[model samples]
Target chain A: MITTELFVKMTIDRWNGSIANVNKHLNALTDEQLQKEIAPGKNRGTYLLGHLIAVHDDMLKLLDMREKLYPELSEPFIQYADKVVEPTPTASDLRKMWEKQNGWLQEKFAKMKPEEWFEKHTAVSEEDFMKEPYRNKLNIIITRTSHLQYHSGQIVLLN
Target chain B: MITTELFVKMTIDRWNGSIANVNKHLNALTDEQLQKEIAPGKNRGTYLLGHLIAVHDDMLKLLDMREKLYPELSEPFIQYADKVVEPTPTASDLRKMWEKQNGWLQEKFAKMKPEEWFEKHTAVSEEDFMKEPYRNKLNIIITRTSHLQYHSGQIVLLN
Candidate 1:
């Protein structure tokens, strides 16, 4: 049988590995490339990167880790689509936010023990959690790993 | 603690969810759109779809489930990048193969018991798996789920 600790560790490994891949892809792109859309009339690399940061930032609230490192990111990246919110932070600033936010999250996530992951995230009500314990904090991490990879592929297409 | 059965079920749920999203995107795309590159000089939608099938087809061997559903896909989609091979299966044929193979694999995966998921897959040796038990059959599914989501994002960009 797989121990819960090992299972949680492997899941974390997948999350960290995907974050690394996105960083590699992002670093390889020029600022001008980040500005280009993946295709005609589609999202630019910068928009996708900003979107990833905003989603990951919300995980703080979703998992009850802390207040968002950059709540300002939510409006540009989440509530609006690529160009809908004219004048987002520069690609350079988004890169810094991505690094700082992910670094902070990595430290916080490492401190989370296996059993703690099985408990409900803050987004769920106590009553709802009692009925559906499967919607745990770790499930959010797993789903977000998939989300990060999805956007990583989109953003990397700019290269 | 969560039961082994529940954990495995949750993981499978994620795999199916991603598959459903991919299918949704594929169905919405016309064949003409599939021929276009995700970005200029990047992979076409048809190539990404075929690549996804080839990877998933290889999982039959990787998971020790069965023979690959389409050995032909390995050369064009896996061995070479898009357009390197003289011609690939029509987008229509690829869509059918994708449906047939994923349908078959889903059936096979649903039959696997939670304990079986922790066992080494065909690709791993007994000694290696003993030393690295985390490299289990279920781990392949998890990683492949991420891969599928990655390409799904790329393919969807054709829309």
Candidate 2:
């Protein structure tokens, strides 16, 4: 039988594993390398980094874990396409934000009980969530875990 | 409540969505673009595509849905690092393999009853599977869905 505790553990393991896979690539790059395009006519490493940070920041509210920590990030990183605007965050700054935000998320995840993960997050209403029971807090984690890995695959190309 | 049917549907939706996301970027690229490096010292678009095909091919056995269709893909795409080998399959051949393998997998997926996904696949024994129930066949689908999106994100950089 699939117990709630086992499901939570597996999900968290996958989440951390995906993040670690991305970090493996990110840690290998230098400041100069982060500015280069992932491919010709594609987003730069720095832009992707900032974009990831912004998305994770938004996840805080979306998952009902916390309020937005970096609301300013949405405009440049999430709103505009890569290289569409000037004055983006430096790689170092974005790295700092990534670490801080992920650290907080990790702590928050640890505090959550397995049963609580089935409850609706802030993004959904209690009624809608009841109707569509699959769209639970755990689903958010699964989707975002994939999202992180997706960007990580792109970031790895910078090496 | 989070029913098994709901979980299966959500997983399938994310699987298809990730494929769609990759296709959007892939459809925009020219044949020549597939040869370009995702970054200065990274895999080319062709390599990632072939790699994805090889992985999905492996998934047939991993999920116990079918037998291997392209065993040869493992040599160049999975075993060797990028650009380490010559005489790789052409872009056309790999693309065909990709489509065919995915089409077969989709059919297999469609035939599965929701509960079947919770059973142990060929890769795991009944004894161990019982001990770690979370390592069900469904978990493979979940992980590989993320795997597809991860590389799809990289392949998109070819645009």
Candidate 3:
């Protein structure tokens, strides 16, 4: 069987791969391109980018890794569900924030031991976690990795 | 650290989740809606569905788990890169084919032990696998899960 260490390493690799893909989609598009909707009246690239930033920021809180870097993004990008209003950052600004968020996650994740990833996240109660240990910190990364790729797919649609 | 068993189980759960998401997108759209381009000139939902079917069919071969059920799909969906020509399967037929494929996989995968997932896939040479044991069957599932999510994201654009 594969070691727990290898499992952790592979999960991180997939996370990084999704991040690279998301960046590629974001970088290839101009800010103007990003302003277009992914579909008719659906979430646009701008909202998707901001949404990802908010979700990743929440990831930090969920795992108890650190304080959120952009907690303000949660309201408009999430919670409200794409009835996006003004006073949000431009696509250009969101791109930079995406980079900043990923950079912070990479640093924090790099320092964490593989064993630490198996521990339950803040969302799960201690008693519940004892019963369902698979709901751990690394599982958050697994879900987020898929989640990022999902948005990345839509981001490419903005192209 | 989490056991290898738990890691395998979580990976499978994510795989199942992505499959369910893809099915949701497929079932929601009319066959006509799926024919529209994901973007102005990029892959359409139809091609994405076919491409995913082809890729998953190949996954069975890659893992040496079973023979491909739809070898014919490789040409239009895989080798040609979605410059689709005439005589492709209807969306109804493709949907049924997808159901058949997933049913077979569910049965096969259900029987597989966690340790079997750690064994090297067919693509890796034995020598290489010895040096890099992480190139295993489970890794393929992990990748294909993200891949399905990526397409599912784009498929939602058809709505």
Interface RMSD of each: 1.3, 2.0, 1.6
Q: Whole-model Cα lDDT per candidate?
A: 0.87, 0.82, 0.88
Each candidate: fraction of true contacts kept? 0.64, 0.72, 0.72
How would you order the candidates by TM-score, starting with the best? 1, 3, 2
In the range B41-125, model 1's lDDT, one tens digit per residue, is 8988889989999998898898888888889989999999999996888889888998898889888887898889888888899
TM-score of chain A of each: 0.96, 0.96, 0.96
Model 3 clashing residue pairs (backbone): none
**Candidate 2, B1-159: lDDT as tens digits:** 656676677677778778877878877888788888776778888999998888888878888867789888899999999888898988777778878877887788899998888888778888998787888887887888778878878787666
Which clashing pairs does model 2 show?
A38-B38
Of the candidates numbered 2 and 3, which has the greater DockQ value?
A: 3
lDDT (10s digit) by residue, model 1, range A1-159: 488886787788899999999889988998889988887888888899899999998998999888988899899899988898988999888888888998899888889888888888988898998888778898998899999989887887787
Q: What is the lDDT of residue B20 in candidate 1?
A: 97
Off by over 4 Å in 3: none
* Candidate 3 positional error at A107, Å: 0.8
Report chain B TM per candidate: 0.96, 0.95, 0.96
TM-score of each: 0.97, 0.91, 0.97
